[model samples]
Target chain A: MIFIVLFCFISFPEQRNINELKGTISMIEHERNDIEIMLDNVGMVYDSADGKEVTALTSVTMDIHKGEFISLLGPSGCGKTTLLRIIADLIHPTSGNVLIGGVSPKDARLKRRYGMVFQSATLYDWRTVIKNIELPLEITHCPKKERHERAMKMLDLVGLSDFADHYPRQLSGGMQQRVGIARALALQPEILLMDEPFSALDEFTREKLHVDLLKIWRKTNKTIIFVTHNIQESVFLSDRICVLSPHPGRLSAIIDVDLPRPRTMDIKDTPEFTALVSKVRNSFEGV
Target chain B: MKKLKKLLTSKFFITIVWVVMLIAVWELFAFHVENIKRTPENVQPHLSGIVDSLTSDRKINGSQTALQMVIENAKATLTRAGIGYIIGIASGFLLALFMSLSKIVEKTSFPYLMLIQLIPILGMAPIINAITGDIAKSRIIIAAILTFYPVATNTLAGFKSVQREKHELMYSYAANKFQIYTKTMIPACIPYFFTGLKISAPMAITASILVDTLQGGIGLGCLLSQSLKGAMTRYVFWDIVFFSAVIGILSFYIMGIIEIMMCPYRRTGKR
Candidate 1:
């Protein structure tokens, strides 16, 4: 009886360990399957004012993962913004499919799964900073108390809690954009879609915001699909840079940025960061 | 000293300075006309005479004092103008809103709106009078017609002035048409709406007074026309002119005040 008991006790942990190993392997497989947004051969064609068909995007296929910071990097007219808009369901793709978490982009938008930030702050001048942050919540018919609480939390997250009552015009351009970011974050969406949000800022403000954004990204762990024409910005901020080229805008390359975590403005001076930036710039040659 | 400097630079104080300078110029001009041109007192009557005409208890039309007559007529004209101004602005804004919503509506109606503006107010007045067949109603209608163009055009322009990116931002939230207008378009168009009001305000007052003058009615315009016929009543004419100027200035400033109240974001003074 004593020998049998000892053997059972000894084998219990070993069996458990093997089971735990299997569980982790399955978890890894689940993570691999967890594509947050899937754009499969998506295309956008606009009918120009002169009645000519303009192809904005051609055969763009990409998969954005959960909690990953990805950038759609390209120059103007590369359809990067158009792609972002398609993902936000602001504009429909002329061909192919876009799935957001196993559902159509339209359905995901209807479910409020996306929080979008534009190049300009786009804050309504009539609404104060806090009220602007509260806009999406208001549209969703969130209770007044919860709406206020969530807006304040978002304001705190962007470090603009003190500017709650200030009007958008009263704040500097950078501050206004921060308020814009807070407004987007207030939605608590599954993904954040930014369309060249920092392109307008001065270089100094831009670098500062980069650090702040990475911190926010780490803290929130939300998947971000940033659209930018800037190479350095994409290299500094994104986990993956999806390089695009214009003239029937199509994906040219996808460069993985393996920069160390908690990256700062200091990384831009590092050779690794410079190499990544050059790689993105060089990827444009495939046009 | 700082308070004094601030007060001197204030808008009200600046307006006062302008008034004083203008009066001095008027006094000089009056003196020149009286002494150098050798004109009679009734022609370009002196400021003192205009003041006397304002305060005098002499009965006008045998029922009202000069001051009392001016007040009654001014009140009647301003009231008609005010009502018509309000109506015109409301309808203009509504039309503009509709025009903005549909390109078809805009294309069809906008040209006629321009045509309405091209028709001289004098030609349009009699047509309105013929249609209404009542003096008071025609006066209101004429005022409204004159006031409509600027509000409609300016507000329409305001609606069109909304940026494409702003529209996309609203769509990103899955906002409906009504929400986009109420939350974004209407509030943004406010400054432009006020600009329309500022322009249309004087036109409304002018239209009301012109209808009265042309059609012959119991308002300041009629009083001026009657006074113009008799040289003895020229002082009263000058007084009416003074009162008309006051009404126009008052309405303009009142619109400005309303604009300030409505658009608090426009106050960039602190920065």
Candidate 2:
């Protein structure tokens, strides 16, 4: 009872320091300017085998700006993925509210305004790459002619057009993930909710995908909420990074990236980027 | 052209060689062993004469005709096995789907189904015959019992073993439950279902033959039983030979069709 009350009291932005309260105000104001998504005291608790509640997210409150690249950076068990899922409406939160463009997550999902990419590639084993990419369009009732055209375009954007007819088994892990990204992008939603999309790839592939993802984001100005464990990845790509701490998951800090737009691979090795990585790492180390 | 050339492959050649060699040895031994045998003093004489008649130049009005008899019985046995096998496989797959999709139906019926498979068909054959009053019905009942098991077991397993991540992926796509089953679960289980088909095909035919023997039918088992009952040893000997050849040919073709159907995906790496 004591821990639950403590978690609830500290979860709201008003209970934090003046500087953090200012940061939270600016964040909400920034989101209101573009009107993307709003979460008011959102909390989630999963049903456990023994009838206990496993609190995944505790009173998470924030607003995500339209077309802003946001990264939810947290340590393991910090409920970063759970927060993203709440926004996506994959699992409903136990209490509080989630508003996507002034509607519920399920409403946003039904309107086809949301798209997601998981930690693993999650490509259908039976589908050829082209069919996999076309799946979302088919479900959304896009005509066959437009579906094929749209799928091919997404594949070309991901540089996988040549292998579109090949099955998932024929592709490497990195290639499979590229296909997964293409499939998610095929719907061309306003918001992209990614739960550690590049976490599975090796350092080389991941780094390459980071550069590729930025290029795609620049061309198509969609709001991206990426959940990741890597500090450097969060700082390099995000316009803002929301840091989280565990054990009744609450906000620690939200860092603004004043880094220049159209960030490149070269920016990843710079001193400023290095400093941000260290800062995020220090936050986790403190927790 | 490719298939014809492929028939000369080693498996076909080896099987042909095995059949020819075994038959030649039987012929030679039957003729050479006219002396006393441990089981029956007249056994060798009877066996030798049977082989002699089967291999001998035809007497137009002879007591039996090998080609006509083999073909006729093969046709009858093949028809019964094929129909019963289809009935069993189709219903079994449907039952498995019911078991997987409805928790209430599964809990209430699946334990009893598993129990049904445990009691051998031999124990129930008399009752089955009494109910149907047809030898072929008894044969169908046994084939149905044997054919149903592998389909039920494999299909249940196939539907239950979907990868958790794959299910999540489908759900993420906003796929309804029916779409998820069609898109992932059914396709994933195809290889296992085909494996069941290959195993059950032979079992279905063999069960029918056994059923015929027990129930006294006009099928090849009757010829076998009659030859044995009257001690017409030559007749019994030819009947056994005919039964073996028909079974070998029939089993080969059934499995051949299943293999052809599944050949394109034999190398599909699902993992």
Candidate 3:
């Protein structure tokens, strides 16, 4: 009976992986009610007629520990978006697999455990700032009064409480993105997947929102997977930066940023921040 | 005042001036030309007696009686047109929504709807009467058919043209299919639907009037026809004038209200 149970447990994954990537995945030890997103030798390939079969992600294995701010840093078309999307359970991988808290993407999604912010603010223009931020709650069927109070608190966290009544177009790019972040924070999910959420804003606005985002992340303590091409921005915001190389993206390096807590915009001027930025940049160039 | 004057000095002002000039020229042609005169002789009137009865007592009745008669007729036509429009638009929206959400609906009903629209509802009036047993009701149905395609096409375009990334964004928030449709897709398409409404609005008025003329009743169209048949050209002219004014008022207000309610994005930029 023990042998039969073990055999069933072992074959469980093999059967489930019939529609998934044909590779192996091992569960990571989840420390708390936090995220442990583990991608095990994750490879994604798209089949073409000429058999080009572009491998968008190739054996890109990485783990995001609980309450960690991780940046998947790469230039455009580096499959960073694809990888982030994989983590979010948005698209099923053609080759590899992902896990959030020892569970598959499907399981993670079914638990209402992830939130995403797109490159564009992706704010519904028809919706007011509060309404847009209230979207996640509405989706998850959060009660009206509590949802409003939480949304207001989130907008306060992003320092846009005053702008809650405004439509997306009424706000600047930076303000729009703040609303996006607030919207993501509405559910207070275990993981926040941001695909270059600040890239649309100007440098000043991006830097400001980075400060805003970091503050909110620390307060909420959710695992954040930030995707960006900006080296400084990634180094500034991320606790660990995962350097990626293009032309079939593969993880080049994962460097832990040893910068201290309650990081401010002033930290960007420090030697540690610049040094870490250069280190991540060197890793990219070294590839 | 100064800013208003400056606004009146721009190319926009010049364009408006040109439009007004063109309208003036058109009105001049209508007044002076042999073909389009509004005299007692140009076209036979429907009920000069009704107008004379209604209008001649302007001093005795405080203009509210004629206003009331005009209002009552306008209200009747408006009610029918309004209800018919709602049904047509609602059906159009449903058809478009069904067609977009599934390939089955698209395949089975979409082409047939297009073909059905092609059969002129104006020409199909007698059959509609036979089916529904009332000519006025038939006219409303015909008007609805005339207005159907635009609303359907616009709604379909709206639903299909919803940004895929927006769908992803909604999904990330754990939005279901229904929420996605109601919140994201519907609102996104309101402006397009309004544009489609603009295209079909005239078809509604014209088709209903045409249908009403085909089978007489107690509408503005019936009044116009009645005046024409009785050789009361003045009354026909007046009825036509009254009908046009009523349509103008309704089209402006109804669509304006819809635009205000559906799309606040427009308000942000302009206001």
Best by DockQ: 3
Over B1-271, each residue of candidate 1 has an lDDT whose tens digit, in order, gives 9999999999999989999999999888888788765544556768998898778888767887888888888899989998999889989999999999999999999988988888987888888878888889888887887778899999998998888877876776778888889888998898899899999998899888877888677888888888887834777788888888888878888999999988877774345
lDDT by residue (A17-124, candidate 1, tens digit) is: 774575455446546798788787899999999999999999998788899999999888899988998998888999987878877888888888888888899888
- Span of ten consecutive residues with least summed lDDT in model 1 chain B: B36-45
Ranking by lDDT: 1, 3, 2
Residue-wise C-alpha lDDT for candidate 2, range B134-166, written one tens digit per residue: 778767767877778788778888888787767
Query: What is the per-residue lDDT of model 3 for residues B11-55, given as tens digits with 9 covering 90 to 100?
Result: 889889997896677555554553554453343332434357456
Q: Which candidate comes out best when scored by lDDT?
A: 1
Name the lDDT value of residue B72 in candidate 3: 58
Q: TM-score winner among the candidates?
A: 1
Q: Per-candidate TM-score, first chain only? A: 0.88, 0.86, 0.86
Indicate the DockQ of the complex predicted as candidate 3: 0.42
- Docking level for model 1: acceptable
Tell me the deviation in Å of residue B82 in model 3.
2.6
Looking at model 2, residue B24 earns an lDDT score of 85
Docking class of 3: acceptable
Candidate rank order under TM-score:
1, 3, 2
